[model samples]
Target: MRSSVDKAAVKMSRRWKLICVPTVIVTVIICFTSTYLLLVKGTNRWGSGRGLRVNQNTRRTGVETTRNFSRIGNREEKTRENITKVVDREQNKILMTNSAAVAVCCTDLMNLDKDKAVIIGRRRKNKGFLTIGIPNTPRSFGKSDLKRTLKSLIQNTPNDLGQSHVSIVVFASALDQSTRLSTRDIVAGFPEHVQSGLLQLIEAPRSFYPNLSALTGSDLYNRVKQNVDNAFLLAYAMDSADFYLQLSDNVRAPSNYLQSIRDFIKQQGGAYWVTLEFYPVGFTGKLFHGGGRDMQQLIHLFTEYAREQSVESLFGHFKDLNVQLRDAVRRPPLFAS
Candidate 1:
């Protein structure tokens, strides 16, 4: 009886131990799984929070940077357009100003003319006239030489012409340093017949450029000629003068120059190829044949030549440097039309 009772107690104790061991193992496993799951969820939440903030910052920065660049580009484009418009406006204003100036000058010239002068075909002459008008230019020719030239012209002119038919007008200046004396003194100094032949002593402006070539190009010359022509028309009541002449202040005339020109003009009709024959100092011997015809025909010839040629070709031929004269020469005579 005691052995059976002991066996039953041992069995009961074994069963109780087995059941408690399994239950403990199950509780341990549940605790470990719950802890692991909680750790994983915390890690995931932390990573998500960091990534979201970083994405928001990146987007915000990109948008702000794009806005700044776009604003800068627009400003630069507006500045360029404004600069272009200003330049165009400036150019237009300059052009308009120049045009107005030209118109005013033209109007003044037209009103001043008495009437439109007529251009007649050249009349034939047995001998052409060389009328020298020496307007007083400052330091144009030396004092002694100028007087000598004038004296020579007076002396030689009488000897050449059978009668005093040579026309001369000494355009003097009261202000000229060289000619302190009146035009009367200068005229009185000439031979009686030559003095008698003196057409007129027109007092001119002191600062007139005495160079014939320079006068040919100047507006002053044109203005003077127009006034002179008007005066001539008023004096003689005629449209045009029959002849034109050129004179040098410093050059002395040869005794036979007039006679030679007369004979040449007689033979050649309206146009004669006349040139100035130079003599060396103190010698009075032949130097060379230089000078040209009247300004009108020369201008005519140049105009005709230009019609068949270009500016380059014509300038290349003469090699002269007078740009205004070249342009005027290359065109038809203003007086001719």
Candidate 2:
């Protein structure tokens, strides 16, 4: 009777082990699987820098116009009121206070109506050595050919090369609701570029313009607004890279334009050249050196002398004063207006 009881006890213990081990294993697997799914779903819907309105812009005035290069940087201690986040993760997006800062970069979704020249996009920092600055205002709104232009530019520029050195900055600086919405629509189409930091949108900052309302239609007032706009564009890009290519909203480039421009700029090796022209259509296809001092000087010239001479003519003036002779044209033309 004792031997039979011992055998039964051993069988019962073995059965319990077999059932309990499988149940524990299944429970652990289910917990991990559920947690992973939820996390992934959350990220897809709300990730860091879902990308700012790649399509929107910042604006300014005088019957007026717009602003910056998202090719990107920053500063502190200048005593700013804290610009609303350029890359605000504030899912709450609770319209924050408006103040001025040297620069602001945004990587997440947020309201953009109140801020001007706020840097909002994936590529907040200046990447690579080239920044393409396109000034699109209310008249055109950067809608015409902007997509095509971006496609070609991006196609010509690869990821590593672009992420490292190339960024396209569209100045859609219209502060109005219409312009803002329009810009958002356009940029939303290129979420990929925004994420990659190859493209960005910017507007002018608060008080970016210095009381030009009184001088409307004066030569000092007329083109100064636009020239100043360009100056702002270049200013935003000054720290972005070694070279800046200024283009109009409606322009086209050849397949080899990027390579050709690279080669041309390289050939200048240590040469003193202020403006390299592609098509001679005002500032449509002009490339300027991205040196801070050089660009600031040129920007100064644009804002001050632009009141006297037109920007196109001013280009010639800058070249004449700055260099004995710089290459003004590239053969077969690399770009067209």
Candidate that would win on TM-score: 2
Task: Identify the runs in model 1 with alpha carbons over 4 angstroms from their true place.
Answer: 1-130, 140-144, 158-164, 174-184, 205-241, 264-337
Each candidate's TM vs. the true structure?
0.33, 0.60
Q: Rate the local accuracy (lDDT) of all candidates.
A: 0.36, 0.61
Alpha carbon deviation, residue 237, candidate 2 (Å)? 0.2
Q: What tens digits encode model 2's per-residue C-alpha lDDT throughout 1-337?
A: 9999999999999999899999999999877765554464332233443332342242222111112222322322211123113222221121122211111212111122323454556544533678899876655333466766767777778777776778888887665768766766776677887887787888775466657777766556657677777777777777677888988766776777778888988876654456777766577787877754456555655655445667766665555333224355766667754
lDDT tens digits, residue span 1-337, model 1: 9999999999999999999999999999977765554564432242344221112111221011111122222322344345334333533332234455434432332233322221111211223234444443334334434455566666667644423334455544334444645444655565554435433344433222223345554444543343332222222211122333334345666666555544533553332122222222211211111122122212222232323433223322222111111111211111110
Q: After superposition, how far is residue 320 of candidate 1 from its true place, in Å?
A: 10
Give, for candidate 2, the lowest lDDT window spanning 10 residues: 101-110
Give the TM-score comparing model 2 with the true structure, all chains together: 0.60
- The weakest ten consecutive residues by lDDT in model 1 span 328-337
